[model samples]
Target: MRGRVDEKLPMDGEACVQAMMNETTMTKLRAGKKKFKRSYRLQKDRETIVYSPTRHSALPECTKRLPAEQAYDVSNILEVFLSTLTSRSSRVDREKAVGPSNCFSISYKDQTPTLDLICTNPETAQTWVRGIQHLIQSRTGETIVNKKERWISEFFHAADKNQNERLDLKEATGLLKRMNVPISSSHIKERFQEVDQNGNGDLDLEEFGQLYRQLTFRQEVEDLFNRVSSPGGTMTMQDLHRFLTQEQKVQADAETCKRIINTYEQIGDVKANDCLSLQGFTLYLESKDGDIYNHAHDQEYQDMTQPLSHYFIASSHNTYLLEDQLRGPSSKEGYIRALQKGSRFLELDCWDGEGGEPVIYHGHTLTSKVLFKEVIEAINDYAFKASPYPVFLSLENHCSVEQQRTMSAHMRRILGSQICTDSDTPDPSVLPSPHSLRGKIIIKNKKLPPDVLEDEVSDEDEAAEIEDPEVQARMQAEKEKRRKELEKKKKKIKLAKELSDLVNVSQAKHFHSFQHSQEKDMACNMSSITENKAMDLVKRQAADFINHTKRQLVKIYPAGGRVDSSNMDPHVFWAAGCQIVAMNYQTPCDQMDLNLGKFRQNGGCGYVLKPEVLRKDYLKIDTSGKIPDKYRKNLTVRVISSFQLPSPSEKSTSSADPYVKVQICGIPADCAEQRTEWKKNSGFHAVWNVAMTFPLALPELAMLRFEVKDHDSMTASDMLGQFALPVDSIQQGYRHVHLLDKRGGDISPASLFVYISLQAP
Candidate 1:
């Protein structure tokens, strides 16, 4: 049964408030069969949840204290759901260990373990779950003023020691240090005294908030406001309309400007007058309307009626490995994480196991194994969680006929009707569109001829697995000898009919030549090529490769020499119209960032419609830094300033000297980068009003990447944050580019202000 845990809970304001205020006793279930009774309560700030051992528990006195270490931030929570919504194996085990209806789990970010709690009853469980979910939803929908107030309140509470609800000079200094506010102690004291209205040495939460605003005031924002506002210090609706159309590049009229004023203008009289004050203008610039990414493309805005081959699919290679290919641990979590990140194509290296079952892992390597049945179950549960597009299982079968049959049975049993088999009988001349195959799972594996029996043998060459450094070095020393031995040892493996019949839409076949593929004209067949081989084909027969991809599917994966699981630049393959460029999802680099940015559009459904040039046969693509003048776009970007950038150094307590790097990644003709001068000791507010221009050959296929790094003379610079998006989706005019950490999590309130202008050649 599909889990309903992800569904939104009904709002129970009274019950939620009560649950947050009172302590609820529950049983904490941990891994390795450990359980303890604990009392959980949400902190008064509503930003943290703390728990302590119950009075009846046998835990030590030191652990029973309600310390800060025992709390978790509410912002870190990804989901709160009943335990019964987990995978089948986990559900059964949790049900048996703790009564089913009373158990719940909190899934957090950054690969943290889920917190499993068993309440005294179902009502109590529902209360906690609804309360947590309510808080998360409220935070997500909070207004600018509410968010800022909460942020200031959280810091004030953190600095207010001794539970006195007030902060003295020492406490205020500590808070400023924690906030990384680059200011002198004397200046801080002066501001503190000014905000201390009653002349008391200590300040309350309201007083502390005033002090924070004084220290973190944005002079850059004030200057921009003055440039746009009237002499009376207020912007009328006409003024806003002009600013939107001319400065932000947005097409806005009086009605639209009025709506924006109503949404972001905080003052009652200013909003009633259909005008925006300085504070209201600031909120408007920081809101989603002013974001760099075009919000219009935030949903399923693309034409989904195109054939599957006419779209780029987000795919993963070695989807089960959590680390390096040689000795990484293989778990179902890898599959879970990939699916959650909108990966529609998952690779499974299946081999025979100890018993009659099959397992998935890197073959002939030290990587740990996970049961194939469990992996299938996990896939069934998470296939459509992030997206409703059809998922593809790219199977690399090395199992014997018996184990292969077992694998097929497990897939059929766990996935049920979601698995598409040969009996579906898709048209052989053309593939189906993503819209037609929604909520389905398609298998991509080798299939036998109709007349062939299960015992019939077929020769299939497996890609060489990544080995240990020493083993790889030895093999390299005797490369020709090793090749000869491998060729001699290649044997014909029997194909099981049960497994073979599952392949229908995506039948794997050996790729011969581009001309040969065109002659065959079979749309259902696909081929997997290594990055090196694919690049070679691109260099030799660029037009032929493009024509071939327009008809059929091609997947390019990392070469086996990359034991570190590094990824190649996917833009090259994408420019050639290759639909699936598989990446090692476990690795993080610029290539992965590009991958994420490319698919981030179209509702992040893992299917991005290929550019018109790539989908049509008549249009020719040139990757040699030459393009027709008609398709060129003159793009100008001005890096205006940044706000609240995080310090890159963990060892140094001082601020950072941040610099911005702007890059255009696309066809060879459009690939270029420019860097701005670093702002010294100004992580909080760095201004660099520098402009750069690029002539992009193909704007539809180009991506704009903005990276902020801390400059250091003694060592390589460290990355603070980055944000990337397609050039086609960039909103023109002044916009805030919200930054993300290396793992792609949002670093809120940390963003760059940029001005963009795109003109046709």
Candidate 2:
């Protein structure tokens, strides 16, 4: 049977489907240094790509040992790209042997091994690449924006066991279970019968859709709509304007309401009458405009003319390791991921390698290595892809003079004009703004002494080695023994003049007392301190630390003891006006979520203008949770309902009892959390309708995190989905907060319905 494309599918999508359906024979590459010829084709349902060993293959025994057919779900694919773009060292030689143009890879979710394939020719490879890309784009669009209808369609197809375009009672019951809908079979049967308008024993796709809607109808939304609309069950422009102004706190007039009605109203008669039905109102409340994030801050609206020290820069620590610091694989893909995520500041731990080349890896560890030239090449390609702002290369140099020179040569050759050789501004007292340094790559490394004409060995790693006192003590105890055992190991490394000359605006400096830094007042010199030291400074001299950051940039990085690559709360350092709070980009946790959330503003340009209080020295910051009247805001959030939340346990047959924990993360005073009672067996449409209020001391520095968890009586609750965003960017109105999975992928059709209102405290 041939799969049929949807009538609504665009021309490109149709072509992609057509291309995918055609059987193609290609060589599949495996990590065990083995390859097998396979015949691959898209499934009839268009949901999976299945491959089988080609019968004409010479190795019949090897083909027999492999699975008869292997399939990959199209929905699970995260990305598809040319195999040459992969950063795995194991694949590098294989790709070269196979020819880069003839190789492509499909990367899937859940940490699945990437499916690498080599086509017979470059044209065939291009065809597969374009076809898969189009399908992915189509799937992503359906999941993010138009998921509700698409979700129904997917389940409808899933339940059609016989593929007769209809579902029997047994199939309908199974579908409800698969959807995680916990309801009595009697109720399901009643709904199914009602939707079976023709008195048939089975339900068609349209009938099943109606049945699903009836089963998962949202009463909370209907009640809210009834309260907001006019007496006639329809909202006119005046009614919508009133709702927007009063309930949503939006500054909207009649024309705005009319535009919204016209955009969201599905019924032509109601739209022509300049009124909104409940359906239109629901659509408008679930759109981008109704998202919790304020659309005004969606673009680059911040003042970018300020000095670089005046902005909160997104930064990454150890931007080479893909996993743990000890044994993680070092790949240029790490640099690509960080840069794509708007990390303007990146760290490179460069060490001397064989063949007069420099390598990047976690020093004094078992972590794998990648060529420094390859990392630089990746940075050059991806630096300005996400944001057109300046990128700061923080070099942790432990390389010999020759390798350092080679590294500098690679940067100059690959980066070329993008590498900022000198400061553009004449003023040496302040660094240039992000706008002024757009498309520029600034190096942050120790510079050679002015009097030194030749390469000189320096103890640059001494301070870095003793970042954690406990680790330093342990190392010191074993240092003498290790030195005796390995007499040839040296403590110092040579600093190359060429590399030092590349350090233009950002010169790495050792941090001393805040008073000493203030006296020196060099804006071009930046210092990086471990999280422990930064917290100590925040405790002892908060105001002075803020003052020091106003003049010079300070970066706070994870402590060396964090071999697991865990991150500290960045809000502490950010509150002290620290420009760069570097995080472990490889780790995904609440802290990283907060980091991404904070940088999600200002068009995600990797530079967010610091709040006025943090920038201005005169504004006194009370670290004790007390705030001035003007800075305080009363935030009220009413979590109305959640839709189609996934079960936390994949093996469990029971539906999820989901609850939302709303946390305000910022300063000590503003930090607070409130949670709703779990709705038992109601993950499909968990409604809390509970309102919680928080008095935010500093709204600008605050982030609101929404975590949805499945309640379990036997053990700890498992997280279902989570999302975090800046408090100030939250729009005041009825909004839908989309939930993201643990790895930050969109778990679309699963979202929280809420009404947000912020007022003067």
* Best candidate according to lDDT: 1
**What's the TM for model 1?**
0.91
- As for candidate 1, its clashing pairs are none
Per-residue CA lDDT of model 1 for 476-548, tens digit only, reads 7666664664556434578899988888889887687998888874899898887888999887777788788
For residues 623-717, write the lDDT of model 2, one tens digit per residue: 54467777888999999899888877754555788899999988778889999999888878888889999998888888999999998888988
Q: How many clashes (backbone atoms < 3 Å, residues ≥3 apart in a chain or on different chains) does model 1 have? A: 0
TM-score of each: 0.91, 0.89
How many clashes (backbone atoms < 3 Å, residues ≥3 apart in a chain or on different chains) does model 2 have? Answer: 0
What stretches of model 2 exceed 4 Å from their correct place?
Answer: 1-13, 30-33, 36-100, 106-115, 136-145, 161-165, 197-204, 423-425, 455-478, 481-492, 622-625
> lDDT score, residue 640, model 1?
94
For each of the candidates, give the backbone clash count: 0, 0
Segments of candidate 1 deviating more than 4 angstroms: 2-14, 17-31, 34-40, 50-71, 84-100, 198-201, 422-425, 455-463, 471-491
